[model samples]
Target: MGYESYQQLGVDVADGVATLTLRSGQKFNAVTWQMHHELGLIFDDLTRDPDVRVIVLTGAGDAFCAGADLNWLRNQLQDPPTPREAREAGRAIVLGILDCPKPVIARVNGDAIGLGASLALLSDIVIAVDTCKFADPHVRIGLVAGDGGALIWPLLIGYARAKEYLLTGNAVPAADAVRMGLVNHAVPAGELDATVQRYARQLADGATMAIQFTKTSTNIPLRQAVESVLEASLAYESMTLRSQDAQEGVASFLERRKPNFVGR
Candidate 1:
């Protein structure tokens, strides 16, 4: 109801297209704890907004979403959320996206790392700039890829490839992502905006009931996956959050050095 009150997300609706943008451009639209909670709530509001026939998720600047805010990660080391809190928050975001009836298009303008990568893969259609990359680097930070990465990656790219990327945290180029079936298209930087706009308009103008119904049907497996897998994943991630390796990982990232994980 109060879209204007959102501090980290920029909400703009025009001609049935609601574009929800991650507004922290200076930090490559990296997500903060506040932004993460908002992401789980905004989709439901957009879905309820009668004028919003299609939803477009994008970043304000060049980067789509870099990942979680390192400051937030550091804070987690000191004041970790309980497992229940972690599980619920993670479920809210993933379930929110899967539950939304409107077609969601991800406008990946730049690199999508960790949670960023999961967000992109969750969308119904993902279009990225050719220069951008996608990766779930939670493992690199000594954490599990629990926040939708493990589930969605395998769904989009299959088990072997998903395992490889998730395990290695390698950044997959946009072209390779498209070829691997991780995203729908990869266009030149100049074409990204226009391309996404075109798709949005098409979906906005298409058969509403049919499209919404189709999206709901398409997400059945995703919803089931959320039910079956998300709880355990988030729980494990929470466990890792309390580990010395996770602390070292955040410290190394902040120090701009390779993490020396002792696997504690």
Candidate 2:
């Protein structure tokens, strides 16, 4: 399939391992709604590819992904959103990653924020560099932690710790994230790429059916827990797309000024 958008994310299968690289240079790999939709399609394709045994997700530049595109956010605010569209888009993206049969690993090359953090947490294993940081600043932007944050963080780090991080929108350093059970391992910056490659190759060389089945089985409970919350949150988040606060949030971000959200 051909993609017109500037962002380039694709599958490269070799030796039973498929590497998916998010190629949006230096702007921290910010994602657009089209990119999210493309990701869903890519995941669907991967599900049918029997040759692929392991999947690795990483970014091209120094940072992994900073999150949603500011321009996309602005357009979303301007157009608002229908309930059906919201639910479909939100569920498709989250479930695509959650339901992938093969083990998925996140190679956190650098900072991962908002939806980026969600991607990292959803993976079967996450390898982060010492300089890498993770955060969900949804609340800071006057929005609920509506994406996978609400659904996955609690499961990964328990209710209390998840609440602390989500509520505060604080940045969690690599070492601190590992200690809090948010990431699988933390390695040196120079070793991050090799570390991820080693793990992905190992899984690729292992029993295909066994690995895929094990991943699916382990993720069943998580998928169940997220189903309802994801449905509800997507509706609420869509409703906000029409609100003045969301508009102000986007404008403030682009203008580099504090938002004057009046809770419209």
Clashes of each: 0, 0
TM-score of each: 0.98, 0.94
**Top candidate, metric TM-score:** 1
Local distance difference test, each candidate: 0.91, 0.83
List, residue by residue over 24-80, the lDDT tens digit for candidate 1.
644888889889989979988998899999989999877799999999889988999
The TM-score, computed over Cα atoms with residue i paired to residue i, of candidate 2 is: 0.94
User: What stretches of model 2 exceed 4 Å from their correct place?
Assistant: 1-7
Residue lDDT tens for model 2, 73-162 = 788777866889777877877888889888899999989898889988898999999888999987666677777888888988999999
TM-score attained by model 1 = 0.98
